[model samples]
Target chain A: MPPADHSYLTKKVISIGIVSELTGLSERQIRYYEERKLIFPDRTGKGTRKYSFTDVETLVHIANQMEEGVQTTELRRELKRQKSQEEVKRNMLRGQINAQFHKRH
Target chain B: MPPADHSYLTKKVISIGIVSELTGLSERQIRYYEERKLIFPDRTGKGTRKYSFTDVETLVHIANQMEEGVQTTELRRELKRQKSQEEVKRNMLRGQINAQFHKRH
Candidate 1:
């Protein structure tokens, strides 16, 4: 599928039902998970949940981790750690680009 | 502290109390965590809980994750994924070392 924006490619946003199918979990279960605040899916104007490729990836990670008997506390920490790493990467890349732009100017 | 058998380094084992101190979790909580199969720490002959640096790190992850509302099931799945990644790394390294050994022979 084409991306929502012109920048990133291949990965695209999907409906909650599609997410449930990809994650091998029931729609009710997915909604339940969101209510518990495990994941925050985007909402439509009609209040329907919208899933993204990123959300599906996260669900895959959660499913794999649970199979190994990891507890919620540890999982949350790891997710946060991953997010921080992503942020750090973005910041480093941005810094490099900014440096290049200034150098060019 | 010194290494257990000296394969890898920097990390060392310690008592459950030490684990508690390092992870900021109570002894009862730590024991509870183990009983739930969240972490598998070593056991002394007297059945005392012996935690390693790795176990403490896992506890820290659990604590942080729980505070963020991650469910137990999801946490378990994530842990399994991480374990698989580690195992893959080990296998790849082993394969490389074996290749080098065969080349020498």
Candidate 2:
């Protein structure tokens, strides 16, 4: 099978109310997280916020982190760190795979 | 380089005071997080809590989340969800690699 279609996770199609219901966070709280730069939702011409599946997950994750007593700035830094670490790991894996593939040929 | 020796991340050798300083959380806050089941620190015979590098990271993550207004219970659930999701993704990637390797042979 082909790789899973993860586009839906990034497609900004869900509304803030739905995201709130799905994430168990109030709409106001979700907006606050956005204000804190923890999540970025898309905005329509009418200026309404639209979220994606990934955004919901992020909101949930952020909420979970906040519940643990993490400050927003620290959380932002941690998120950035994790993202970079994942990128590095992905690059290293890609290099290894390319090396192995070339060796077989 | 032999997988970069990530064992230090899991080795329980750091003290609570150090962890507090490293994560920018108070010793009492870290203990509170532990009480809320957000972190698990090893204990010495004298009842001192010894943390790993991973634990320090976790404490920082938890604190960051708490700062974003996530409740402890929600954070726990989100952490569990992320762990399982990562496991699933790893398994899928491993399976794909195995399949590709076998096909080449």
Candidate 3:
């Protein structure tokens, strides 16, 4: 299967209000999460915050964990761990593809 | 190792002032957590709160979670889950002990 588009992960397509509705989190809570460095939504030229799909997904995950009494610092650590694991998998896949190409040549 | 004694877990031995100092939670926060039903400290006949070590530990845990932006309801659920798991383990252990005694007989 083709890899998912990275653009969709980053494209700021949702407003904060929509993000609140989708994530079941208050706008103030979203802003508080940003202040805690749990998420980073993009900013408009006028300084309004716009959220990407990634941001919305993160807020949802955070909400669930927060409900579980998980600490923000722990959540941040988990996020970093997940990102690192994904990077490692991506790198391993790239290396395998390169090796297969060389073998064919 | 023998199973840890449960008496120490429930024995109310500390004042709220000491709990506040030890747990690093304000007196008001401790009361609020009680109001939230997160911890149930014992009360004197005159109705002053007295904390067990377990209550102190739970407060510390709750404080950490609250810092992480965890919701109270979620924490309550987690607390209930932990209690249920402990009860299940205790029941299993009791069943094992009873089975061993019956086998010996």
Off by over 4 Å in 2: A1-6, B1-105
Model 2 compared with the native: what TM-score? Answer: 0.42
Q: Write the per-residue lDDT of candidate 1 for residues A2-65, one digit (tens) a residue.
A: 3255321112234565566568977876676566566777655677665645666677777778
Cα shift from native, residue A25, model 3 (Å): 56
Identify the candidate with maximal lDDT. Answer: 3
What lDDT score belongs to each candidate, Candidate 1 first? Answer: 0.67, 0.79, 0.80
TM-scores vs. true structure, each candidate: 0.41, 0.42, 0.45
- Docking class of predicted structure 2: incorrect
Docking class of 1: incorrect
Question: Candidate 3 at B17: error in angstroms?
Answer: 2.0
lDDT of 1: 0.67
Q: Which candidate number would show the highest TM-score if scored against the true structure? A: 3
Which tens-of-lDDT digit does each residue in A1-105 have in candidate 3? Answer: 654744635555456765776688999999998888899876766777867667877899999999999998998888789999999999999999999999999
| Residues B1-105, model 2: lDDT tens digits | 233533546645556765766689998899888888888887766787777667877888888898999999998888789989998998999999999999999
